[model samples]
Target: MTLTIEELRAGVPKHSRKMITQNVVEVLNQLSSDHGEDFAEHYKQNLMSMSTVLKSGTYNMKDYMNAVKFSAFRLMDHSDVDSYMLAFPERYQRLMLKYADYGDEQSIRADKISSFVTAYKKNEIVAKVTEQALIPSRILNAPMFQTALNIQMSIAMSSRSDQVRSQAAESVMKYTMSPEVQKIELEVGVKGQDEIMALRTEMHRLASQQQGTIMSGTNTSLEIAEQVILHEIEDHDDIDISGELG
Candidate 1:
């Protein structure tokens, strides 16, 4: 019910008004099943058609960018986008290979760290180094964690483009790619992977030392999902009760 074109504009990173309109329209439609057509209609475009805007070249950079908080690190600098867009090739086939090879290692480290912390919390793994209730904050403050975070920022920034980000993806691809930049990207990715791996190894050592109720990483993730489901159910229940009382 809170959804609206204006709300989406303020919530999402500031961009072209036409783009915000288009993105919000898509978001509301996607949730039409659970939220109802009326809810989706609240943000639906009218008067000026989306097709007209698209033809005019008004575009949104983050059509796939959801505002919902997920278990992933996101970098958000459009101005420095030139640094990241240069990292990807114009062709989808080439893009996949580059990602597979130079994929951000921080994403991997983030998964490991998140699982380790979840287990630590539900299982109450105590750190011998601190001799106190294991604080995830302590681990987060670890030097490696900060470095991993920085690496992800670099990857995110490198994936965006400033020149034609406002234009559609096709328009951006028309520009020429730099060979020297790709060489530098490869060198940077190699060094980053090495550092990321070392940091991950240290974190694994941290996890091994701790005693917990949930030792397995797989089980830890399942537990987290269960917790999310319960929270959502509670929210829906509250909404129903509120409506009934009204």
Candidate 2:
């Protein structure tokens, strides 16, 4: 039986239903044909599950749909590059063209596959895939991390330039060592001059009131000072600081 768009998009929210474009339906049907009905159904469920993370408002509809397409391609067994290219010429061409400026053909292909794999591994869909495949998530990401470390090691050991090698070695140490404590600096400022002045006036009034009540005696030095401050503030009542305070 062929999978229909309605069936593939069954659990998606109504408002976001249109995001499952025709291209997405075509990919899902292809999965059903090539991987079997059960695998394709599971893939659809995984894609739907990603909507939970998508609700964060970070991703738009296009990004969500692209992630769905990218994840679908990654899940498929595309071990033979030539055969996979033959099967999906457009996808192959697009990826090749996108990474054309990076390096040679082989490197470009590696970079393309690595990008897709990285996206698949980082996305929330991997959490669902991990649960179903019963593989540790760390294990899935292990190779990529190792690849990064290998590149850094190569640069640190073989680079002839002292500055570059020193920088690479420092990066390796920074990554492998315990991370340094990050200092977060926050800046706070009153938005308006009037507000700042009003706040200062309010603080002064409170301080004066508190100083007045601090002494037990009715006519102590502190009491007299407080009374004088209160009288001065009262004399300036015509300035109308209340509106700014509020």
Candidate 3:
């Protein structure tokens, strides 16, 4: 049976889900284009099975590579193997010699087949497939995320209870609205008498500077009043004037 991308993504961790799912989809598309749809379908099934095992977090990279290699081998026909060996005779001969230590003919043949499959995985196309198969899927997609907002909208439009409808509408609005940018205000206070006195002296100097500007008609009375009030608020112990205006 064919597994959807959504189903495949269910087995993946949230952090890597999107990246892995996208890569898997691309690899599957490439497979379908290179081979037939039937071959790609079988490969996808194998990938799904591997993904299921992956959810347990028990499988290692070697197990994953072997799984993909065997999956491709299972789909290979005699003609396919013959074509591969013809294409890479030296590699196949090397693999056969590598497995010659096995005692019986059947044992040697089985070992040769296993080694051949492993070596086959190094081919460019097969390497791409194996790399993608190792990654898990995504947890959420755009459609699924939008579903919650859609439900809220429906409730807001058609609910029987007016209060419930209002609440739902408010919720929908809350979700749809762009978040307000928060403004942070930090206030540093002077608790020591020495620090307070130093601040008072600075405020007096600033006020004197402003007085000359006021006399010269460069500064307004209201501006001077605001500056004095701000300084007074800073000097006071019980008052807090550090916050956003709105």
Best of the candidates, lDDT: 2
Q: Kindly list the per-residue Cα lDDT of model 2 for residues 17-126, writing each as its tens digit.
A: 76767777787678778768876775676567545444445566555644554455445654435434534568778888887888888897676755664554566544
Judged by whole-model lDDT over C-alpha atoms, candidate 1 comes out at 0.31
The TM-score values for the models, in the order shown, are: 0.18, 0.34, 0.28
Candidate 1 error regions (>4 Å): 32-63, 66-246
Q: For each candidate, what is the lDDT? A: 0.31, 0.52, 0.49
RMSD of each: 26.5, 21.9, 24.1
User: What is the per-residue lDDT of model 1 for residues 97-130, given as tens digits with 9 covering 90 to 100?
Assistant: 4455444545532433334333432421111111
Between 1 and 2, whose lDDT is larger?
Answer: 2
Provide the global lDDT of candidate 3 against the true structure: 0.49
lDDT of 3 by residue, 41-78 (tens): 76656654444344434554345434553545444643
Clashing pairs in 1: 84-158, 84-159
Ranking by lDDT: 2, 3, 1
Quick one: best TM-score, which candidate? 2
The RMSD (Cα, Å) of candidate 2 is 21.9
**Candidate 3 — which residues are off by over 4 angstroms?**
1-21, 58-66, 75-246
